[model samples]
Target chain A: MRNLIDVTDLSVAEIDELIATAEDMIAEPDKYAQVCRGKQLATLFFEPSTRTRLSFESAMLSLGGSVLGFSEANSSSTAKGETVGDTVHTVSCYVDIVAMRHPKEGAPYAAAQYSEVPIINAGDGGHNHPTQTLTDLLTIHREKGRLDNLTVGFCGDLKFGRTVHSLVNALSRQKGINFVFISPEELKMPAYIKENTLDKNGLSYEETASLEEAMPKLDILYMTRVQKERFFNEADYIRLKDTYVLDPEKLETAKKDLCILHPLPRVNEISIAVDSDPRACYWKQVKNGKFIRMALIMKLLELQL
Target chain B: MKIDSIQDGVVLDHIKAGKSMDIYKYLHLDKLDCSVAIIKNVRSGRLGKKDIIKIDSPMEVDLDVLGYIDPDITVNIIRNGVRVEKKHLALPEKLVNVIHCKNPRCITTAESQLPAIFLLSDAQKRSYRCAYCEAEKTRRV
Candidate 1:
């Protein structure tokens, strides 16, 4: 009955458990290879998300579970005027679990209502992508060795980045967390997030425009792209697209062990030169993304450890 | 200016002036075959000017519509030509179909069959968000 529509749906202990399970999966890949044998996963992607869809399929396949379902609305019954509930209800009758991604916000949540099996929200428009947050959390925990008492700086488009919102929400529950948000005034983190999470808990945080100005003090640097899809005006998108480009020069003032992370498909926001730095862990985030999803699939299905 | 009192119906009092029509429309008073009177801009000692709605039938009203439109309003249930219960309204925790989600990216926009559910996200500010999309909507009327 449990469905992950938002990162907040998982508690601190549950998140720790998921991270632990993910770490164990990384350690012993052979142990979980056949855990999901004979089980099926339905990837009900109503949008085209190549990396995310592939990652879910790869994760299920790694668990020896077969994958089925569509990649876009045009290829499915949705194109034939079928509702999401009808499609998911029909798909759930055949599959053991469901992984859904849709362009409209809350489609996955709506699917969970009609689905007989457990539902995992892959990504829902710009609203929520909890699995991405899990990947980020796993990356941070593996790199930093802890999740609390460290300064986390979020850069770039904090406004529309669901990853930033989910991560901030997850991190806010931890003890002694300091947040430094770096973005232009137009792209600052939403006030509701600050008011409801950080300020409500009395957590310390500061806002600045320059990433370099906040770099030296950060323990974890999370960068995000200024998504063109979120902006309605082409002029606004063009003006803010090149706002912050993180290159090697920007990392000169950063700490050596700073865990630099980005949710990828980068278009020059992260310079190619920064890839060689030991602190840059965005690649590892991709690797961890699969394992954590495997753990999440296992957890939601209540499969054996 | 006097209106006949109902025998076994409901009286909505203390509605903020000029908000009676919205409440009437939301409550679907126009569709009712029974007597429904919307008295507007009535002089009040406390509110200065307020609106009242009198329903002649013993039909139930949507409390959420009344609450969201004007929570300051009071409700009186009349039974057998006598006052039965006087109820004061407060902002409801959830609203279903009282208002629609304006966000174009919301799932409710495409699926017209889906119930339009909005949750009271911020009570003090009277802010509601679509249950599906979490799109913030402030009080419109």
Candidate 2:
């Protein structure tokens, strides 16, 4: 594919290939260090995102490639009201690839239409985040050595969590994957997603308000922050923010091999005390994010590792 | 009373009743400098009531959009006041720049230059989704 705009853009085989490539990068990092030598990656972030932007930059740098472009729209020609198409066209002339994060849902898609270079969607407005999905996939592959037959529990904000949606969509394609959605009533998984991704695929899934009850049966626990930004009302945000914090007490009943994952910049969803737990692989997930991005950049650039 | 047949033009027949105005606006029929007639709530054997638009000038119309709005629509071509050819419409596989995506965060909303495209994802449900954001197209704007 010319661009990685959504998780669905990658097929099951391609995801496996990426995971394998990521594993190779982890084992022998030096061999792939200079794969992207003399190349340039433009990071055009229209919104404020520290982790995703940095991870992309780090991925490129580790591959012996250079990084350019703006971290914010106001810092770039976008402040002058330059269109995404125009910006992409201009940036494509200078860079080999682009990793764009925008507040607009399909801004990267619009850019991809005009870009001569490969475009990677770092994040979009509550839309799909394919790279994070990749990161999660790699993490799961490393932790459990398989993507199938796992009872995965998604805790906290499943409604507005783009990561949850992307991961669910990706994982649903795997065989024997059952979803245990743990969230409050107000933050239940959207019907369209349930209908289109899960129900359409004939995937098994169940919903519950209690994370504790779901913990024992879960092979993987994917926790997401209840975003204050997604809430329109302060009262609702306050009420739901602390609904499902993954403390030591909550993790007590979880399986010893239950791999806990989270897309970082987490806002008090997982407690600090649980960080030392063997199952808490979120930190490793972050590192895996960089490795997978490196793999993806290499794949998009058609460089053999 | 019977509406006069156009000598050389197009006839949009079997439009769902009350939807002719939307089609007129969508096609910019008002902007056409030709004789145009809209017959609304006309009795028909196939359809209990329907709307028909007769344009007395030969011009290109977006059949795909017509299909999207109402797949049951029939487009009849008139030549020398004779019904030469008739065409039926079904939902197009993909529609480009036909309707704006309503999602506020959709790329088309931010970049006006980008054509708002929708793909017919669910044929049974007649559901279309924005090609860019994958947001379901609820209505035409």
Q: What CAPRI grade goes to candidate 1?
A: medium
Instruction: For residue B110, give model 2's deviation from the true position in Å.
Output: 3.0
Where does model 1 exceed 4 Å of error? Answer: B1-4, B43-45
Give each model a TM-score: 0.95, 0.96
**What residue pairs clash in candidate 2, if any at all?**
none
Q: Candidate 1 chain A — worst ten consecutive residues by lDDT sum?
A: A44-53
How much is the TM-score of the A chain of model 2?
Answer: 0.97
- Candidate 1, A219-245: lDDT as tens digits: 999999998888888899899998999
Scanning candidate 2 chain A in windows of ten residues, the lowest lDDT window is A224-233
TM-score for chain A as predicted in candidate 1: 0.98
Q: Candidate 2's residue-wise lDDT over A51-122, tens digit each?
A: 899999999999999999898999988899999889889999999999999888888888888999999999
DockQ of each: 0.75, 0.80
lDDT of each: 0.90, 0.90
